[model samples]
Target: MDVPFGKPPVERADAARNREALLCTARAMIAELGTEKVTMDGLAERAGLGKGTVFRRFGTRAGIFRALLDAEEQRFQAAVLSGAPPLGPGADPVDRLIAYGRERTHFLLARQDIARAAVERKGPVPAGGPVFTQPHIGMLLKQARLGLPDPETLAFQLTSALEGPPLVFLSMDRSTAEQRAERCQGDLGALLADSWQTLIERLAGR
Candidate 1:
């Protein structure tokens, strides 16, 4: 069989090395100086590559952050999918939801500066997509066989309640992160308990 020469060849080993170098430098810059201070020029200078090379590798500063955050999100997702109880698979679904909220709240607060950068650049969070939290909650609702009129819609509502921005914003009123997390957990407990009772009543009527 003959191959077409018009197609581009696979990336060369040196090009891959260059890409890895730029990513490594960019991550170090982000850790040392925060996302806002990590610029294309700085990355190029630090990696000993040309500015054009950096831009060609990532397109923009936002693209670099997007790549970094993508890796971080994958690790977080893996933890939720397979790591341990509560946030993983061993606990009740509702308890898992509570643990997820607590951990996600903490994660967002810890990386708030990076998160702010991602938000300003309109990057995606796993929970914000249908591929993650929304589906997880929706499936749990169905598994619980709750008599809610719209399980999917309710799932979105619950997932949104666990989002970082609103939680962080609400905690700004002289509340510590610890206080906010505890308050959120208590609120979730109350909301789920009330909803469960309502669901039971609705099912009894049928």
Candidate 2:
């Protein structure tokens, strides 16, 4: 089968060996140090590979971070999409969305460094289209019976509010990170709910 990135396909044997070595070395380094300390040069030395080879495999520090974040995001998505109530399939939409935001806030707080790096160094290509949060926010608004004049615009606004404050606060002392995240999540959830209610009332009056 053809690869998506225009690279020639690797033979199965070579690919397996390379994958195993890379995973083993990366895990050992991460265990000894931490994700932030796993530099390209350090990883290269540990894996017995050239610096260029390490870069070729992962692109950049952010790329490696994203690879790790991708795993976490997948787990989060699965829980929100399928696992349980409030966060998954068995709750009302508002509850599900609130749960989603709360979980996201907790995750981002825990992985602040990785989250910041991912946001700063976005993927080489945009994932879908001009608006990133439209689908998610639109679904929530629809379920809440919120008739937003422009779902796309409202979605972007809500997403920004949800992600911005905690990131700013988290850059400070580590002692207050959890407290700040909890407060931010509560405030954000309230703002979103109130905003939707006001929009609905205004539309109803018109």
Candidate 3:
């Protein structure tokens, strides 16, 4: 019988052990040395494994970083799905959108280095895919029932504005990450003010 593609066969015990060890070591090295400085050879040496073993495990430095990043992204996505009000299910979609902007600003700031590495490797950044938060924002837009023909496009426009070049350039301006997150909330609120009442009415309809 063929298993479903999303369900992988179980890993062998020893293989699982090696994978865990490698990931643990890699995490430590990333914390100590930063993502770009954490080389494949260094990981293999520190893990006392052959370089080929590291390759078999993760394919490349980019691969390992992607794995680590996916794990982190999953947690953030979970919060948006079910964790709490504003960022989760219990609040109005517009409030949730604001909450999302704040949380994502902080998340991006914290993960900026890994994000930069992903960019360098032409890997997935945190803003483009359905697996990322953009689709969630699109869902919020739909929940608002704004009568827009392309809620996803509006979602893209909003996220791209908040998480785009201006934010990155602002990171160099000496504001703390927390300060930037506050600014994001303020900016988004101001930008969406004209449409805010419409969003509230839509949510109230539900």
Candidate 4:
């Protein structure tokens, strides 16, 4: 689990408690009501906190989802770091790369709504991935021992291929990405993943 660039400024004990309470409430609300239905006012009311407090903690409605997404990313990265083979460790680098693409596709597409909503109307769009992506992919490409002229560049290109496009979809036409991504949870995920595996195989010449 990569931290977002650097350590956050420490929060007071009460602020920490409030952050935890609000995140739990927000998750429940989103699960029950969906992303569009979860709002700052509604969350404050449900969580029994002040609207100003929610605003200070999250900044904007989009910030709430961003906070949530950050927490989710930490958990996802934890699984990759220590959980099991293929996505975690103890598997061939190429196999891990292939598995990462498939699993990561599912993770992003499944959270399309929240990822999209996290975008600020005025702020630059956020990438739908953790910062660990590029370096992790680069390391794996090297370990795979492919005879490429520039595995480093290819690693970056591959990371973009795996992460960037799905994110582009996330910011598309209102909620089209959300709806389509929900549908993509089945066949589309497999198609993208299969394509990734094929690309890796060809690169590996196997």
Candidate 5:
């Protein structure tokens, strides 16, 4: 498949191979050393390529991290959306919502280091950003039939309640951590469920 560009098709094939090699090496480095240690020079050396090649493939270290975060987000999405009951289907909406938050808390705790590394060098975090789970939160709220004056705003608040506090308290002893997370999930879920029920009743009256 010869591209119309002045260079021969072999050049394009070589370029694609180099790009693949760089991305593969970068992924390996990130998995091994975490995101913080993944630099263009390091990736280049690991890939047996050059720094220029790395930059050409990913544009910046942030770009590489973005790709990594994309992979993480996909895994999270699949787990929450399709993996199993409670987090997925086969449960009542409120129960599922509570389970989702609890599971997300656990996921974040497990992947805290990679997550921290991914966000360390951020500017404006991208909309529907790979690192943030805002989409999942919104989807759950929508499925729960939570009609908010502003769905997006409510989703942010709910997700904050789930993610923000646990990340703060994750350093506690295991028992304490579990207790706090359970309390947060239960309290928040109860509050939101009540609000959602009220909203539905009010809408019905109309």
Candidate 6:
């Protein structure tokens, strides 16, 4: 008899508590001092955890931001899974796709800092954007019945299109960071949302 061999071991309760405390402390430090000022030593000191614990939990500084981004992604995914109509459920597949694209565009743009910071300088670049992107898009495409030959491939391409540009943009922080952030929330968001709506509508044969 063969047993399953790939399950991740559960975190011990004390370990989970330490992780929670560290993440909470990191967030406050980031808010007060910005992402650039956060360091492993700083985080460990603030959380009252040892440096070894921090190093063990997150092997590199990028891991800290990655962990934070992972938590935020979970919350965002939860909203997509069970929050409300259009983005959540009870809407046409085409509508949901459009809404998801719009929301995802803003989500990536707004969190560009954390997303960028999550990248390890020496590690291979991540592809297809964040978790759930391809699968979610594929499900919506299939439900929409677009008559496309390769929805799976299209999903992968679309995920890169939606997430790659913003995170990789050099212009993202060229000018005033505050101004850039404001525009992202306002005009830039509107433009991206409208563009996504147009793309989805055309694909749906609207």
TM-score of 1: 0.64
lDDT of 4 by residue, 97-178 (tens): 8888888878876777888789888778886464688888888888988877888888788888888767778668656765
Best model number under lDDT = 4
Q: Rank the candidate models, highest lDDT first.
A: 4, 6, 3, 1, 5, 2
Which is better, 2 or 4, measured by TM-score?
A: 4
lDDT of 6 by residue, 1-206 (tens): 65455333344667788888888999999889988899999998888888999999999999999898888888889999898988998899999999999998888777767766777875655443556988999999999899999999999888877776665552345355557657677667677778889988998899
lDDT of each: 0.65, 0.61, 0.68, 0.85, 0.62, 0.81
Misplaced by over 4 Å in model 1 are 1-20, 119-131, 145-149, 164-206
Itemize residue pairs with steric clashes in candidate 4. none
On residues 1-206, what C-alpha lDDT tens digit does candidate 3 reach at each position? 86766344355667878887987888899899988688889999999999999999788777777666676788888888889898889897777876776677666556656655544344434444334656788888899766778888877776675567434543343346447648777653344443434544453453
Candidate 2 lDDT over residue span 62-81, tens digit each: 66666666666777777766
What overall lDDT, based on C-alpha atoms, would model 1 receive against the true structure? 0.65
Better of 3 and 5 by TM-score: 3
The lDDT of model 2 is 0.61
Please identify which of the two predictions, 2 or 5, would achieve the higher TM-score against the true structure.
2
Q: Candidate 6: which pairs clash? A: none
Query: What stretches of model 5 exceed 4 Å from their correct place?
Result: 1-24, 119-153, 166-206
Clashes of each: 0, 0, 0, 0, 0, 0
Q: What tens-digit string does per-residue lDDT give for candidate 5 at 53-155?
A: 7787777777766666566667877877777877777776656666666666565565544444444343543434323556666665676675556766766
Rate residue 97 of model 1 by lDDT: 61
Rank by TM-score (best first):
4, 6, 3, 1, 2, 5
